[model samples]
Target: MPPTVHDRPRDDRGYPVPAITPWEDGRPQFALTDYQRSADCARQRQCSVCDVLMPRGPVWRVVGAAESAAIGAALAAGRPYRNLAPTLEGPGHRACMLYASMVCPYLARPNARRALTAEHPDELTAAVVRGAVRGALGAVVGFADYEFAVTGSRVLFRFVDVIEYLPHDNADAHLAELRAELAGHGGGPARPVG
Candidate 1:
């Protein structure tokens, strides 16, 4: 059974994305990804955005949702989540829960399917928008990917990029277009990542 969190909308996939917990500054505050995969540094650091290191942590898959009930326990104990793109990149859908939490308003919907179609699914919507927005603005610059955990009104976007991905080289103009797309959804002003 899922935890007794407040109701929220689901994405086209039927998965629910709730608002962030511990609401900060009125809006749900996302954790924002921060991968620690610096080879240049010393201590064996790993990315928190994409890697999942739990007591008996399951190997990560692209778009894999962290057990909703388990999120609090996992974080309280302190674990690292890794993006599972490399292993799960073989075919089909290319969605990640980490990726979804950030920009997909639909993912948080209770009936994502009611809002999505065969061609335009939840993840597809997120990717197209995020890829363009983040890709252009360059905030995608820091993370390979990230995770989402919500409580009452706060959202945590734990960045988890490491071995599987690298930083974007430069910002692009199409970024402006991407920002516009994102604005239509997340209830925010459209702007470039830079």
Candidate 2:
């Protein structure tokens, strides 16, 4: 079975520890990307969640509604969206993506707001904080081939040839169904390729 919130390691604030999240002064900075680890994951073709080597395939990414709409529009127009828009987080296995969607405060709760800290003065953090304040309607999970791009000191993923997109209004229900399916299969990771 995929690990539950309680099953995963927790930070001082009881937040589930994301595999690739950077730690600062013993705290996980959820709003920031760990550039070195992100680069390593990209180079090694690893799942950002489980840190396992993912087979060559379309990986899963969780994005906000704005990005989803942009991608959808780009697809309808028969245009590529990768260069115009890039994701901050790396892709992961399907199970890991679902698990993160189910457990992450920002993804799971629309009312969850990211508190701005003086330490994080970057534009990315500012953007995240603004998004959180406005509230999110839901999350979109997309499967696609991705390439890494370096912008300044940050590493970003530009998704290409997206095969499918799943919009989830209720992450809890979605994850429960996924968990049940995995349980029926004797509890293993679900790998999907384009």
Models 1 onward score TM values of 0.20, 0.74
Clashing pairs in 2: none
Give the local distance difference test score of model 2: 0.65
Model 2 misplacement above 4 A: 1-9, 12-15, 72-83, 117-126, 134-137, 184-194
Best by lDDT: 2
In model 2, what lDDT does residue 46 have? 85
Per residue, candidate 1 scores C-alpha lDDT tens digits across 42-117 of 0222222222121211112222222222332333465533433222011100112224323443323222222222
- The C-alpha stretches of model 1 lying farther than 4 A from their native spots are 1-73, 86-105, 117-194
Error of 2 at 56 (Å): 0.6
Best by TM-score: 2
Q: Which digits, one per residue and each the tens of the lDDT, describe model 2 over residues 1-194?
A: 35533454668877676667788998887766688888888888887776778777667777765676666676678766563455568888666776777777667665666655425556444465543542444554555567887666777777776665555655675666566645765134333211
Sliding window of 10 residues with minimal summed lDDT for model 1: 86-95
